[model samples]
Target chain A: MNAQQLCDRYAAGETEFVAAPLGGFNLAGADLIGINLTRADLHSASLMFAYLSRAKLAKANLSGAKLSGANLNQALLTGANLHNADLHGASLQGADLRSANITLATLLDANLIEADLRGTNLSGANLTGACLRGANLREEKRTYSSSLTGAILCNVDLQGANLKGADLPRANMSGANLREVNFRNADLSEANLSGADLSGAFLSEANLSGVNFAGALLTGAKMERVLMTEADLTKADLAGALLIDARMAKTQLAAANLTGVRLNRADLSRANLKNANLTEAEMIETYCARTDMTGVNLTNANLVRAELSTAILTWVEWRGATMPDGSEYRD
Target chain B: MSVQTSLGAIAQTFAQHNNALRLRKLIFCACTQRWESDRTRLEQQPWPQLLQDLYYRYPNPEALGDAIFGVVKQLNRQGEYSRLAQIILDQLTPLYGENATETTQFLTEQTQFFNEETQFFAPTAPHLDPDDPDTTTIITIAANLNAMEQNLRMRKLLWCLRHNSWENDPQALLRIDLATLIGDLQQEYPTREDFKQALGQVVGNLSRRREYEAIAASILEIINPLYHAMFSPDPNLGDALPPVVMVMEQTPAATTIQSLETEVHLQTAISPPDLSEFPALDFLKSDNPTTTEYDLKTSTNFTPAQPPPALQSPAVKLPDYDRYGVRLAVMKYANPLRAKILAFSILNHNFTTDSHEWSSLRTQPFDDLLRLLHEEYSTWDHLVEKLTATAAQLEAPAESTQAAEAIAKAMKPYYIPSR
Candidate 1:
């Protein structure tokens, strides 16, 4: 059916177009609200600027479709195949995309706010500069965690997004605005978060091994028990961040600002803290075996009961610093 | 532009597009879509010269071969093909072959006739001679049906009507008057079907006078060629789709696009293994998830219809056509089969379940259907209804048939008979 015919029929209250062969169709700027096109062959179709809000397209073949600037808000796209689809700048706010195969689709600068994306396959998809604030990527019972492996999330504004236990290993999230993003128990290992602002982000118990946080703003971030082995925090601002019991073996913390940061009982073995400002940082009972603390400023910092014996402390400022011996450093 | 200028343009374009591969598509297109006489004309010419003529005639190989064939058809119908071909052959003898020239000289004597010839074709193709600012082109008023089609919303304004975009648009109109059924056509435009009907009515009325019949034919040529391919005894038509009045069977210009894969050299293409020239019906079938009524599972119980009387009798059948000719003609019907199926479904609504003689026609593989249509149901109007209804559906509310219709339209002159 043509767009106009479909619209006319919709006006007459007939809406189901299940499995329609509408491939290569141009429905640009059309208003197709609430249409049920389940299992429709929409490959290579152009729905650019089309209003498909609340549309039920579950299991639709949307591969290679051009849906740029389309408003798919609250649309049900469960089990839909959107591989290789270009949804650049499209909005899927509050949409239910559970279990959809969206692999390699380009969602560049798209608005996916509060969308239910549980169990979606987003591997290699470009979500660059997208806003997924309040979006759900949590692993629910009977539904696998949404896989975002190899996703390009560069400069994305994911503030307040719920990514609890989502598989996001190796995702590129450089320069992203991840403030208050819930990463509880999520896998973010080897992910790029360089220059990202993660202030007040609740990242407790997240797997952050091999992650790059160079020049990132992690002030007030909750990283309790995070597996941060081999992570790069070079020149990062982690002031007042909670890193209690975090695994920091071989982590690069060179020239990073950790003022008033808590590293209580955290592993710092073989970690490089060269030239890092650790002023007033609480490092009580922290493991510091063979750690490079060269030129590090530990002024007024608490290192009580910390293991610092084999640490490289050359040129480290220790003025008013509490030592492992329960006495203050006089220099 | 002069003949030399046109030739220079051709030569320049040829230099840029000298793949020799591009010509294979052009030649294949020409060989496929051309009328019998046109095909014969192409066959008579040497390959290099034919390549040059085709390039100079159309230029864009990527375009539909139908358009290329359309130009030749128009020229041939005007009886101008023989005249033009003889002159081109005589004058361009020195330009190609073993004794060829690098630079071509101006055909000064033929330039006048060429410029005059360019004027008649101005409405047909306004896209030529664009770079020549020094030349003054002849202007003619033509009915641009395309522009009129776009503004289908305007009540009677069948006129994209000088309201703009008319110059670039092809708009030379032959005003056919049915004594004033004209109905203020500029205010309330009729559907294209209606317009065609009115034109046919006007032309039919005027055909009584022998002198005006030529004008009548010219006006109707826009709606012509619907039955031309079927009835025009194109070379060795044989028993392959005998002349039926309304049957929209294979046309001479019906070439399958396996156009150029380098993989489809005639050696493999001619292998009579039902190679399924036009495949991929997965997208064409209406996969209505709500209804499993059209599934192929029901195809098993269907008893095949008895073979047609003509096929059984073998009365007055002509000599055998070469494999390529048979394949080309057979390939035409199968390609349009997609359009036919979609159009058929829309018309026959319960086409899958209906217990007609042609029951389960849609369920069969494209190859089987082609064989059935070729060997048995060749003369049935039920088969012919594919084209007619496909044409009619173009005017209907369902426009998903547009792509299929367009592909079919390009290969054939669209005519939905008055019924």
Candidate 2:
């Protein structure tokens, strides 16, 4: 069916149009609320500014569809093929996009709050500056799922998004807003998170090995038992972050801010800490054997019993800090 | 009986209804207490005063006959003679004689197509016929479906039957026509529990056909609105026409309908529609464990092979699927198709064009080859452009605009006009 016939039938209160062959039809700016176009061939359809809230387009072929500025809040797009679709500035809040093929879709500035995106293949998709608070991008266990692996998520707002156990390896998430995001048990190894804001994020037991956190903000982040081996954190901020029992051996921290960071029992052996800030940091019994601490600031830091004697400590500012020998440093 | 109570009771029986003002106006035009010149003036007076003027002023047989005849004439002109005919007859028989043949004859003669045998309009008669409507009425209604489809109430009834999917037991369905079904509804299930039990029987183990399952889902969708309207304890929506509710009110099941809402509310009480609120249709929602990805039903199934995990946090709030038909349809179709497409893609991963499995994937009836092609091509626009170029090469002379006009156009210096 073409756009006109669909609209005419919709106006006549006949909403059931499942599996319709409406490919290449330009249905831009149509009010098709509650429309049941399940499994429809809507590929390459121009649905710009269409009000399709609560629409049932499950498994619909929307590949390459132009859906810019459309309202798809609470839409069921489960298992849908949205490959290469342009959904720039669309509102997909609370939409169920679980297991859908959204690879390479352009979703810049999309609002996907509380949306279910489990097991979706979002490889090469652009979600720049999109708000995905409370959205679920967790991995599906029973399938060959790689949720957002290699996705471009620059400057995207992912606050409160549950990406637990997600496979986001090699994903480009630089400059993204990841406040309070759940990355627990997630595999983000070798991912570029440069200049990203990760304040209050949960990364407990996450595989952040070889991750690039250069100039990234990790303030108040929870990294308990996290694996950041060989990861770069040059000039990255980690103020007030909790990294208890974290395995950060060989990780870089050059010129990185670590003020008020809690590092209790953390494994920082052979890790670089050159010119890094450690003011007011709680480093109780943290392992720092053979680690570099040159030009590091340790002012007012609680480093009581921290195993850092074997580490290079040249030019380290230890003023007003509680040393590993139970003695307070006095400039 | 008091006139107001009698009116209210009669109003309850109206499958189709009108205001007291129209009834009063018909009585006014029919009443003979006022003369031909006095009708225009008498109609201006209030109904309370007119009621006194109509009954108290006119006690003679000639005046009563004139009033009844006038009302019948006006009602006949308005095409409402059949609806109010029984009311007039009931009122007249008590005041006049038992065998009021003159009024009956006059009433019958005034309206040509009254067809009092099917007294659907009679307030005293049962709202639903004890059997299905005659074949002629059904056929006539079927013939002019478009015209009759304007009546949503009628259409919903027809839709219920169409979506019920009687193919499993065609004989059973054939024997149970619409009217007969409604009539049987009066006697078959005395309580709403029985109705629900029958629905469970129908929904749980009905049929194996995919079409039937789809139809069942739609029927369930239709039932939501139908249920609320039919079993609503109070007519709170103020809907002008409520034929189903009216029919239910006259049946024994109506008494049990008072608690049906509470029962439904309990089932849907827990979570909002994370994906959908069609929990009752769980059979359709759940992925069949026995089926492989190739066996998955919906062509829309782009589902990952992975089983769904629990929500990481309780902060995620979702809208209910029962909020609208679109949500319901989404939820209904979301069931049972989560793991197949990935399996299909994996099976076709080797991409051996000459292989039997690869050929099967292309020829499989349920498989979406276009989508697979779309995924490979990246975008349909690119595919179309490539096809158009190929077509250009094939039909170069017949279809190419470039060959027709652009060949002679001048090539200006700064004008690469690819635009």
Candidate 3:
């Protein structure tokens, strides 16, 4: 149907317009509030700056649609085919895009604040510089597993977002603000999270192996049992973080500030922690064999039962620190 | 002596006393952690290259052989079997014939020989040796004095004390020596007497027991002062021997040290044990602390192992909500805006002044209006009755009763059919 007919029907109080074929139509700056466009064919349609608040577009074909700078606040687009859609700088706040096929979509600079994207297929989507703060992308409800697998989320602010069980493997989230985000059981393996702020984030049971956390601020983050083998955490601020039972073999934590961090029962074998400040960190039962700890300050740190055999402790200051056998290593 | 003779003498000395504490210290100092990589490469070189490098760096054959033997022993201690075997092959092939079988046999025998030599030179417990208990205290004092004599400054001071005169010495040097000028250093330094007593006791023990070998070793420490004095720059010190040497010449200590040189010379004459055979020596000697020390170093210092996999926390599997069920559940809560719009149309088109439901709906809170609608209109028949009754009350004589019918037609499509 043409844009004129849709507008005329909407003026006549026709809110039910399911399965309407409105492909390639210029609906720019249109007010379609509270309209039902369920299963509608709006592919490649120009919905730029359109008022789509409270509109129902469930299972709609909006692939390749130009929705740039559109106001989609509180819109229900569940199971919609938004593949390759241009939603740049669009306001998707409080919009329910659950189970939507948004693969390869350009969500650059989009406002996704408080959006419910649970089980959304966001693979290969370029969400660079997007605001995903407080967005519920959690897969807590099992059937719809929300994932950003291989998505470019660089410079995105995801503070307080629920990303539980999300498949974010190999995602480039560098400089992203992930503060207070729930990353429980998320697969972040081989992902580039360099310079990301994950402070106070709950990352328990996350598969974080080979992840680049260089210069990232993980302060006060609960990273218990995180599998971080060969991960580069160089100069990262993990101060006051609880990393209990983390397997971080061959990980590069050089110059990282682990002050007051709890790494109890963690395996940090062959990790390069040169010049790292581990002052007062609790590392009971930690396995640190062959780890290059040159110039590390373990002042007042509890390393009780820690196996540091073969670890390069050259120039390491363990003054008054608790030894592996529960005895203080004085001076 | 010729270079060959000197090298032979050095090799003999090293092989005989390879396990001595003093030799161990020298070996460890030469093969420090800094030179470990260089040492590894050096072991891979051919026997001719190894010999030439050793001789060129340390012209003293005795010191060269000792250093090489130290390297070999250190490699063995470190459990570098491949490097050790390669080095032994390089050394043995040149000593024995170029026959592969003979060289292989000799290499195998050398391992056992070195182990036995290590055990033979091991220090015994103090209580195990009857003479050790009585001599240990004096030996310890003499050892401390020996250590002090090894100091470069102490060597310089001993030389100065022997050459410098109290009145003729420079004023600055004389002031420090002035204290010693009035009071002998023996009287000024408290430990001086202890050293002298220990030295005297060791000398006496050697002379009475006729243990010329022990005397030869003890007198080396005793003549250290004379050795330092020989290097003095005093013009008056001309061709004259140091005072301690002159004193030792008058005693049996000189003969003991002289006998060592003669004994080494005699051994050189005997066509030195044709190491070509390289007979396997018993290596089950239990007293060697070198092996134990090496074992402790490698095990405690840096045994690299993989981290255990049991540290990973069990992953929490989130509940996967069925999409259809989730959609159905979400539909249970009618949108408040839609419900309010429908309610407004109902109140505008059909409302009765006498109906209890209309009065109840007006009295109910705005937030509870949806609950009121759900509770008031449970069945279609009940909803129709209320609409028709309200329509009947609002109908004028000229107007048709079509307001209730219009309201039902407007809301029919929005309502979900009950199962």
Candidate 4:
């Protein structure tokens, strides 16, 4: 069936288009709300700015389709093939795309608020500036289930997205824009997020143990109570960030910028902070036991009551910084 | 004294205890509600000191239980019972065995009762047929589900009130009417889909609101029924059965469910992941890299990006005997062939004669050996650059990243690090 026929049929109250061969149909700007197009062949179809809200496209073949700015709010796209589709600025809020094939799709600046993406394949997808607040990218129920496993989300933008409880282990999200993203309790262990821009992100209590944030921009990020044990934050920018009570045991923050950062009561035991900038940073009562802070700039930093026993502070610049004692480092 | 009056006196005593001069000023470090400011101090207190503090607050065991129960109730309003339970259990641990105080025993009994009752219903709906002749059973089940759902919703709302980032208005709590909420939930959830959709909304709201602890707690609620059914030694374990069973006799559904419980136990025995069974979120938050890595490696239920499992393919390898013993028998179609093939390809890529690749193929039913070969080669090629960099790091000086990379590379299946 052609796009025009489908539209006419849709207007005539026939919503079922199951297994319909409508490949290459120009459904651009079509108003097809609440339509059921399950298993439809819509490969290479033009659906730009179409109003397909609440539509059921389960298992539909929309590979290489043009769906830019389409309104797919609350749409059901479970197991759908949306590979290589152009979905720029599309609204997919609360859409069920569980186990959907969204690889290599262009979803730039899309609004996917609270979408169900469990086990969905978003590998190689360009989601620059997409809003995925409350999206479920969790693994399927049962042990070792298919999740966002092997998904390549390199350079994707996920700024301001709420990824609470998201399971993104092993997903490549390097160089992604994650500013102000809420990743509370998200499982990002072993995930490759190297060079990701996470400025102003809220990552409290997130499991980031094995995350590779090497050279990532984390300026002003609030990572309070985060477990970053052995995490490689080498050369990462954490200036003005809050790491209050964060556990960073043996973490590598070498050459990282931590200017004016708060580490009050934080555990940084045996952490490698060599050459890190701690200018005006607060470390009051912080645990720095046996930490290697060689060549670290501690100018005007507070270390009041902080445990620095057996710490390797060789060549550390402690000018005007507060010592573990009540006295100043300079004094 | 009344419970309220006694609670006030106890609160005042607790305040005095807080005011005792330690000369050390504590800092509030953790952000948001997830932080427990007194965690360090409370955890460090000796048993005698803890008991003295408790004695100062309440004279008798009943009073102590009452005080603790009051706090538990308050926490329960927000579904924050788990943390409170942990704190209470910690405080009462020294009282266990012959040294057990009357207060501790009462608290323990109350806690166990609370746990059993609260963990009554799992998130998954019980099997109930609407078409059953016994409408009474269906009605009872529906009523119980409604009550449970209402309780969950109320807790969620209370949590929302506490976690609301916007203007904190105390009036929000006043707006909730328990009766009205129960009435609303009682309005027929005839279909499981409707129930699931509603539950999804509740969880989605919790997630969006950044109520992560609540989300984790709710996940626990889902697993609680199964956990108790499989593990709890209580003979009266079935006392908390679905309301349907109370009204109706044991049927095929009940029998099948029992068998399913057994199956769950068998699966748990087969895999150690099941042993760490607090909830799925507990596993997620666990610091054990091996556990998380193992979990990541095994997850293969919905590989949407890849082509349908070559299980159906005429050329795919089908083992004459299942490798995982009882696990294979349980999961039925779970194929480890691909993971094995990928591992083999990675270790040994070069073969002088094509016979090595073909002979390794064994009973594999695929004529498209080239397709398999291409997939494995590309994965290896893609990983080579990263692996080489890691290898370089290993030579320079052993760093955490290099070690992590080596471990990740080892655990990674062929499908991951997708190109």
In model 4, where do residues sit more than 4 Å from their true spots?
A1-8, A11-13, A18-33, A38-51, A58-74, A78-147, A190-195, B1-419
Q: What is the DockQ of each candidate?
A: 0.00, 0.01, 0.02, 0.02
Clashes of 2: 11
* Model 3 segments more than 4 A misplaced: A141-143, B1-419
lDDT of 2 by residue, B73-186 (tens): 532122344235334333432232212222333222212222432322212122432232332222222222211211222233233333443232212222222322333443
- Candidate 1, A168-249: lDDT as tens digits: 9999998787889999988999999998889999889999999999879999999999999999998788999999999999
Residue A265's lDDT within candidate 2 is: 91
What TM-score does chain A of model 2 get?
Answer: 0.92
Expressed as tens digits, the lDDT of each residue in A122-194 for candidate 3 is 9999887677778998985656688788999887778899999998999999878799999999899999999
lDDT accuracy of residue B324 in candidate 2: 16
RMSD of 3: 37.1
Of 2 and 4, the candidate ranking higher by lDDT = 2
Q: Encode model 3's per-residue lDDT on B10-69: one tens digit a residue.
A: 445444543423333233334342222112122344333333345445322122334444
**Residue B365 C-alpha lDDT in model 3:** 25
Model 3 chain B scores worst on lDDT over the 10 consecutive residues at B289-298
Specify the CAPRI tier of model 3.
incorrect
lDDT of each: 0.56, 0.56, 0.57, 0.53
Which 10 consecutive positions of candidate 1 chain B have the poorest summed lDDT?
B289-298
**Clashes (candidate 3):** 11
